[model samples]
Each structure stands twice: as C-alpha cells, then as structure tokens.
Target chain A: MTDATGSEAGTAWRRIADELEAAIGRGDYQEGATLPSSLALAERYGVHRHTVRQAFRHLADRGLVTVSRGRGTQVTAPRFPYRIGRRVSMRTNFGAAGISVAGSMLGAEIVAGEAEACAALRLEEGAPLWQVEALSLAGGIPVSTGVHLLPVARFPEFDRVFVESGSSITAAFKACGIPDYVRLSTRLSARIASEREALLLKIEPGAAVMVSKAVDALPDLTPIHLIDGIFAGERMEMVVEPFGELPSPPAGESGA
Target chain B: MTDATGSEAGTAWRRIADELEAAIGRGDYQEGATLPSSLALAERYGVHRHTVRQAFRHLADRGLVTVSRGRGTQVTAPRFPYRIGRRVSMRTNFGAAGISVAGSMLGAEIVAGEAEACAALRLEEGAPLWQVEALSLAGGIPVSTGVHLLPVARFPEFDRVFVESGSSITAAFKACGIPDYVRLSTRLSARIASEREALLLKIEPGAAVMVSKAVDALPDLTPIHLIDGIFAGERMEMVVEPFGELPSPPAGESGA
Candidate 1:
C-alpha cells in the first residue's frame, strides 16, 4: 500500500491508511466496497483497535471512505469537483462539475425596498426593486436557498427575464446594460436551518449551513445585487482570495 | 420583537422571530432559559406552531438560541468574539478577548525533516528541526491543538529557552536573537475530526474543525516557523488582512 517512493511515515494507523488509500486507488477496493472492520484490520495489522480507527479517520478526510456504525467503513466514490473559483457563474459552476441544477422559483416580484436591501443597492429606502427567491440544487440535491435583490428601476423587466428565461443571472443583468460586475464584499456565518430549509436540504434540524451575504457592484460603482444564500455546510466549501494586499476594508457605509 | 423602526410587513414567522429577538434583548428571556414552546409562542404571537418554529430558526442563526428535540428552544448568550484579526500572536489574541491559555506539551523532540517539511523550510531532507506538539486551551476548554517547527540550528538553545522561559514560541525565538518575522502565507481547509483529535477537542468524530498551515519568514527570506493549527470550528474564527503591494522583481533575477 506504499506510494512509489514510500517515505511518508506515522504510527501504524497512518501506514495502514496509506495502504488502504493505495488499494482504493488501484481498484482493489472498489467504490462502495465495505472495508474490513476496525477489529479485523487491527488483527491483520497487529495494532490496537484504536489504531485501525485512526486509519479510517484519515481515509474519511481524504473523501475516500465513509463510516456508519452499523454498516462499517465503505469506500466512497470520488465526487465531482465542487470548486468555488470566482470566475464562473453559479449555474455554470454546477454544470461544469457534472451536477444537475434543478429548482423551482419560489417567487419574483417588484417591491418597495427594505432598509438593508436599499442600502445594498445604494438606493434610498422604499426605492423600487425586484426580489427573487430560489432554491438552488446540485445533482438534483438541494444545496442552498437564496434571495436576490436588484434595483428594478435600473433593470426594467427584471421579473420577466427571471420568469421567462433560464439564462444565467449575469446574462440577465448584462441584458439590462450592466455589462460588468465585481463582487464588492461578502459575510459568512453558520446557523441552524429552519424547518423549510432543513426539509429542502434534507438534513436534521440542528445541522449547520453556511450563510453568505454578498454584494456586487457595476463597473461604474453602482450597487447591483444583494444576495443571501444559505448553503448546506456538509456539502459545500467557500473560497476567498484577497488580491495584492491583505485585510481589505469591509464593505457598506457603516461597515455593518 | 419589532425592529427599532417597528415596520413589520413580511411573513408572520419573520415578525415572530423578530419579536422574540427583541424580547431577548429587552431581558424578557434570560440566557440559557427555555423559551415558551412552539405552541405557546404561536398562541401568544397569533401564529401557527410551525411559524413559531420558523422564528426559532432565525434566532438560532444569529447565535442567540439553540434548539434540541427534548430541550425546547433556549436562549444562548452571545458567542465569544473570536477575533480573526491578521498578524496577531495566538496568546495576544486570546488574551485580548480575556481567555487564558494553557497547554499540555504532548512532545518536543528533534526530528529529521520529511520531504514535505524540507520543501516548506527549504532545508535538506535530513536537516534537523524541533517539532513541538501542544494542546492549547482557552477558558479552560481545549479549543485548539497545534504542531510547530523551528530550525534547530538557528535556535541553538531552543530546549533551554522553551523549558526555562515559559514564553510563547515567538518570544523564545526572540530570546535566541531572531527578533522579527513575517507570516508569508497560510492555507486553510476544514474536515471532520478523527478519533484522536476528537478526544482532544472534546467533540464527536464527525464534528468539523478548521485546519490551517502557515509559514513565517524572516527579513532575509529564511523560514522562521512552520505552523499547523487545528481550531475547533464552532469556537474560533480567522481574520486575515493583506497590506500594501507585492514585492517587485529582484535586480539579479531579470526575466526575458
């Protein structure tokens, strides 16, 4: 189970993990194959039972294995790359990774702006805006539910575009002459899901999900969109890249 | 739970959640105290029981409440401000937040550099370095455990300073004549815990933790420290700030 140049070392468990990983890679242990129990592996490797458990833990982290108490450890098939590179549309991201995107639009309507939404759009409170709520999916599995706001006066027919076309959000915005946008800021935190969200994401009540609030701006610095996305934490990761310097100032006038 | 402005036009559950949050702020519900059951809240707020449950979910995300099956929704005190400010010592950060630091040094030993460590430290594969493993605690709760590597040749009296001074690693390096260092880079990821780390962090095996690998460098571009820290995900946050601009090309290293 060693690598071609076997220099990696740890206690017995790590060695066993490495060997198991190699066997998985070599197809000796196919995806979904049940691995020997910790007791069995311990007996075979002549190590403590705890040592075998450690080996399984290492494999789990690498996405090579999953353990269920009653079912034991089983190989996990390699998952599609869930990349969070900023250069793609959210829709394109899932599509490129071979995941299906399927979700019913909850609602789309023009409304008087709420205080937070107005501030995010750089408009006065009560200004006209289009708000859209959608459940986003990957591989037909609900991953996030999001609400997006955009100034309706700036983008007339926003609701129609959302309703009639399956185009990317960026495309919809570009059609309104806001050709380019840069993400100005984002805030991330975690929280338990509501029953509705939990049902959508198919997780327990107390399971944590990532809450992301993002603001984007047009090239001329006009605020364009404010989005609140709740992501299933166990199924997702977020990547942030700070350009040239560290600690860019937080966004918004009050920095709230 | 009205907002200060007291305009409520959204869903019933949202307003209920807001009112409950306001009531908490008003000291109507003490921290750790169970809230009225969903039925009770629904009756008081004139909403459905499910709507009250939805309100509780909102409070949970704000970190103000926790809900369990047997234990109803309960108020929680504000979480510790896990400051993620860039470029602060671990001790300094925790100290500023009024948390004490304690450690049980798992081991401190001279180790031959592995290939990965050698590449990171720019040393020969067999070069000697001091590897120190410690379980660090805050508020008397173990929240992080880490391993640090320092070049043994540079800190000639490493063991003596670490043993005698009881100072932080940075201070110990300063005592050995290396007075300044800058963190070069950090890599971040997250994964569920293993049996060993789970025991150390006092969490279940599937609980997530934050993982960071950082390299610190001295003025002459020599590596000073290589640190790998794992923080309890629910208990800590990391802030990073980049400053100024990237270094320009070296005169001696002209490129075509």
Candidate 2:
C-alpha cells in the first residue's frame, strides 16, 4: 500500500491511471485537448506502453475521454449536471435551468401494464396505463430516451396534454385537481441501451445507459406515476440526497 | 418516429435488438447458452447480417454476453448483487445476506484533515483524524474499496479496536462508548476508480465505480463517521427508498 501520492504501491498501470486521472480532473488536459501518446505517457510514467493504453481505455469507458485509432486520445467535454436530486419533473427541471425540453411523441397509447410496471406502481395486475414513449432534448440535443407510465384512471387527459404541452406530468396532474406529489422509491441500473434508445440518443446501441425506475405518489398517498427513465450515460448525471433524523439515545444516557 | 411493434420503423436493427433483448431477459436462452449465428438471426429476423452483428455488439457492451468470431455469442453468467441500499454497515449488510465479508487493512495513520474531509466530518480544518484504507471482499471476491475518516479527538483509542476486530467502523465506535448512530445524508456519483481502488477491486482503472459519500451522526447529534466507499460498478446495486408526505391541493378547487 502506498500513501496519497500513489507511488510505489499497486500495479504500475493503476498508479499511472490514478495520476493521469487526477491530472485530467485538475484541468491539466483541457477538454478537447489531445492527451499524450501512449509511448510518451509510458516514457513519462516509466511504464510499458500497453499500461498507458490500458489506462486510456479505462478513461474512455467512463466517458471521460475519447480515443481514436490513429489519432491520440483527448479529454471529453464534461457533461452538465442533470439533476435527479429532487422530485421535480424532468421537463421542468431542465426548463427551469433555461434549457428547452423538446421531443416528438414517439408513441402514445393505452396498454395493459407489464408485471414490472404493476409492481412499481402498486397497481392491480393488467391495469390499464398510458404508456407514453418519448425522447427528451436539452437545447435541441437528444439527451435521454424514456417512457413514463400514468394510471389511466388518474390522468384521464394524459394523451391530450402529452401531445400538446409535453411538459411536467405532475404539473398536469395538478391541473387535473392533484396539486402535489412525492417520490417513493428509486432503483438504479446501468445497461446497454436498446437499439431504439441508442438511435434516438444518437449513440452506439451498445453504449451505456443509466436506468432509473421511480414511483411517485399523489397528495392522498395514491401511487400515480411510475417513471422509467433511460438516459445516455455519456450525457447525464443522477444525484441523490438521502435524509433522516438522528437516532435517539437510550433512557438516562449521558451526553458524554 | 416508431409506433409500438408496427412496421415502417426507422431501423430494422433496432427492432431485432429489442426482440433479442426481451427474449434474453425472459430466459429464452439461459446463461451459457449460445445464441444463433448472425446469418441465421438475419434470416429469422429478416434483417441483414450486419444488423444481427450490431445487436450482438449491444449485448456484449452491457456485459450480457460474450462473442467469439467462430463460436457465436454466449450468454454471460449473471454477477452477484453488491448491496448498497440501506444505511447498515458493510459487514452487517453482507453478513446478514449470508455473504462472508473479509478485508485487509491497507493502511492506517493519524493525519491532519483535508479541506474536503473536514467539511464532511464537521471537523476543524487540519484537525487530527484517523484515516484508514481497506479493501472489502464478499464471498471471497473483492467488491469495494473504502477510505474512512474518524475524528481522533472523539475516538482517542481508534487504532486499537480497528486492528483487533477489523469487522466494522460502527463496531469500533461502540467500543469507544458512542452508540446509536444515524446516517445523515448520502451523495452518490459514478466515477472512474483510482488506481489503488481498481487494483483492490480487481477492476481496471477507469472502470465505472459507484462512489458514495456519507456522514453519520451519533444519537446525540455528534457527527461521527464520514465514509467514502467506491463500489465496483459491475457488481454494485443501490436501491434508494425516498419517503415524504405528498402535498395537498391548493384552496378549494373541485374537479375541473
């Protein structure tokens, strides 16, 4: 084990990668700036050329850099924070940040909820839900392809509002007499996007997508929204802030 | 735009990919089963061989299958679930799930708190803190790398219990007469693992790692634990439960 300097410790490639990563993070290599060739990196770090390549490969996989066959690797443009911290609608969240939220209605139809959908929304089996598939754009660039489910009984005007406004579904619910909502739970998974999502997001089908499944509740505690968002992992960041009160001490416990 | 399961979609490769993905998820081909040849898949799906290849590439990128030029693609074995859901200790969470938890103390030393560390633990800048690094294993397989920060002034005998038990930092706190703690907040991010963490977790540097920064408070609201855990993305899963009271309707509006 080594100290924070990360020298004389683990595998040579790893040490090289750490130092290089810190350098990149510290803005030693600005966005779109070409990184050193593997040979040059090897010479500087005193490691095999392949070690540097492996390090670069790692950075490429994390969407931190771009590597070309003949041309040298370059640091990637950093993505803006796609805030997923609050219970706000995706459209409003971006719109509030002055980013235009635009996407065509890929499809809009009433369908029997899938088993996974039923479980997430806490609805009965085969409940009818409006499954609206759409893509979300940030400043006219596709950033995510997703599907949102609303219980048909709860949002009777879903299709109408969806086609016209394409804004916050929760806000639309407020217009329909449900003013507010709360997010219940979320499940996160990373996977290769489906060919459709990839095409919509303008990335390779095998590209990573960050999948989030959330259950939202109406003011009366009724589950109304089960949103399944699939974001181009290369384009977005999901944040979570957990809250809780401190545990109480046993009776007569001293402060010390 | 493509409608649900209809003809005249934008791309044939996407439709083929979706069908294959659903089939695989539904267990049409079990783990270790070889998928049909690209030529055969093209014939069956009425698409070009290149389309099938594209579909397979998507599967491979998600680590769902492995492809050999001559042998075709085979379903990959599913990985174990790396639980990061609850506020429980790493040892307790894995142990209660009947998974063995083991780790080697990589390094431990008393040091002045860094700016970030001080802010996290609510300690004065440059205050003495016990910094410990460890690599954790589950079922004899490395899954996470962690660095812990403990205020030395609060736990005067921190080093002794850490070396003796090596099970959990929470247990160490109990031995120091501080019990009943609550997790205050947890912030998560996806990042490339440092060289040291990559080596410890048996993943390549630059592989996506789930980073969680958490602060723990004592029963009496004294900040105690500031933990930074890096979990191997291939194995980790974080299930977050968000609970809040739903908002009520604004003054007296009946059904619109």
Best by DockQ: 2
Residues B172-220, model 1: lDDT tens digits: 7678887776655554445555567778988656555665556777756
lDDT for model 2, please: 0.66
For residues B1-256, write the lDDT of model 2, one tens digit per residue.
Answer: 2255443432676566657767777778887799889999989987779878887876674456766546679886655443333254777667777998877677777777755566567667788988778788888889877777889888776767776666467677778886667666554545545566678889755455666656777755457777777777657665555553223223212111
Compared with the true structure, all predictions reach lDDT values of 0.65, 0.66
- Find the 10 residues in a row with the least total lDDT in model 1 chain B: B247-256
Candidate 1 is scored at a TM of: 0.69
**For residues A231-256, what per-residue lDDT tens digits would candidate 1 score against the true structure?**
77656655433321223112111100
Question: Number of the top candidate by lDDT?
Answer: 2
Each prediction's total of clashing residue pairs, residues at least 3 apart in sequence or on different chains, is 9, 0
The CAPRI quality class of candidate 1 comes to: incorrect
